[model samples]
Target: MTQVDKASRKPCIALMGEFSAGKSTLANLLIGSDPLPVQVIATQLPPVWISHGDAPAFRVDLDGNQFAIDLDNLAEAPLDETAYIKIFCDEELLLQCDLLDMPGISDPNMSSEVWQRMISKADGVLWCSHATQAWRQSEAAVWASLPPDLYQRSLLLLTRIDKITSERDRQKLIRRVRAETEGLFLQCLPISLLQATAEQDDYDVWLKSGAEDFAKHLVDLLHSLSEDGAVGPEGQSLPEAAKPLRISGLVAPDSAPAPPPAPAPQTAAPQIMPRRVRLSPSPQDRACARDGAPGRPS
Candidate 1:
């Protein structure tokens, strides 16, 4: 085995979730460009590791053999032999961190080995769960097996919030998710990736879509992870204003409290803050939540 060098690595954030959980859309929103084709994303592929550079796209095999690959035809990479596809982009967001877009955890067609082998490469994770069926047992089980330190650095995202039509149900879902996942992540945010992508220039739409808050939180997470010395280059210290509130604890509660009944969603939009990435963006099912609410298995 060759020695692994950690002195010059940037923090890597992995985009992970069940199939169609908006992981690819989140990747596109962050990059501000569609590097991963929608058709390719819809198909099963190994982890696509994206970094900041102008290098040509390439594929690395399980045995560490490298070969150039056409970015236009990503579907040709052999799933059984390929380790990951290394793609470079000049996006500002990539300057701060590398994004590893992993295959869907729930895809029956793809073996877990494809993604499991890549988890060690991540400094943090953005676990996307579908709003209608958020935080299933399988997701929690997988998360429980990951590095415990990641709980402080990671986030739980409820994607496709627009599917829940009523404001009452939306707030109810968000609050419940936050409560249930209180100790598991930095924050649990709700977002509609499609809405954020479609209305990137609209400030109010960004706020209402939950993208604004997600962006700010994401930036903060990057800073926190970098400052905490998680594979960040030297001389990078935590800024005075960037002290994240989530890094102080790693204690998981014995049990999360049951979420209270639904409150009417706030009509006022959250204030927006500028972020490097335009697209920004958790929970379990329980009986308390109804009408497309998440209900954790009893």
Candidate 2:
């Protein structure tokens, strides 16, 4: 099937994972608001394509027909005939890129076609795996099966890292996953989505949650995709050497000590970081980020 016209579209990043692995949570976190209800997110719904706007919610069927639907009653959308649900949000982050929240790869009640059919619509992915059982065999097999071009630009995020109480065990788990999927992903990072989303105003808590590093890497990745010619027009393929992007100040997973906290921006920055993620003020010449507060100057 033909995907969106890349020549005129923003980069699309897919949120993928097994059921309850924080895919919905990550989506909510990124959008800075919940576009779908928790109950609706938990159901076996199709991919939700979110963009930056106030357009009403709608559904796209397998036959490529469009049907307007009430966002509050997403559960009522016929799953058997739907290809994806389109929801437009006004978050500034959506201005930079689009987010496609996919179904859990491991849902027993859902068919692979539900998500597989939407993969081609993505430019990259944020693969969420539960920290307690990060990177299961099934997940790895599925990830391995994806086109190398797609996987190369994606990041494997170990969601709910806060659940792994022991620092030692957390480090060990990250090490193991990184080694096993060494070259399969751009990077494998651990994060506590709950903490990052809950403690938006507290900078230290947000940084400790690993949201800072993840945000930096994510911004860098998106910038590269847009500026480095990583994503081409409709019919073109990704470049072979477009794998690594410069992630300034990003610490290794095994030794990702939180950087020393800097003072919060004097003013809210652009919404580059997640709704909760705020960076310290940097030189005015450097790129500005979210909440009217700019990110650290490059």
Q: Output the number of the lDDT-best candidate.
A: 2
TM-score of each: 0.76, 0.77
Question: What is the per-residue lDDT of model 1 for residues 136-239, given as tens digits with 9 covering 90 to 100?
Answer: 88888889888898899898989999899999999999888888788999999998877765554454664578765676688678876666554532335434
Q: Model 2 over residues 87-162: C-alpha lDDT tens digits?
A: 9977756756789989889989989998998998888999999999999999999998887887678999998899
Off by over 4 Å in 2: 1-4, 228-298
Output the TM-score of candidate 1: 0.76
Off by over 4 Å in 1: 1-7, 230-298
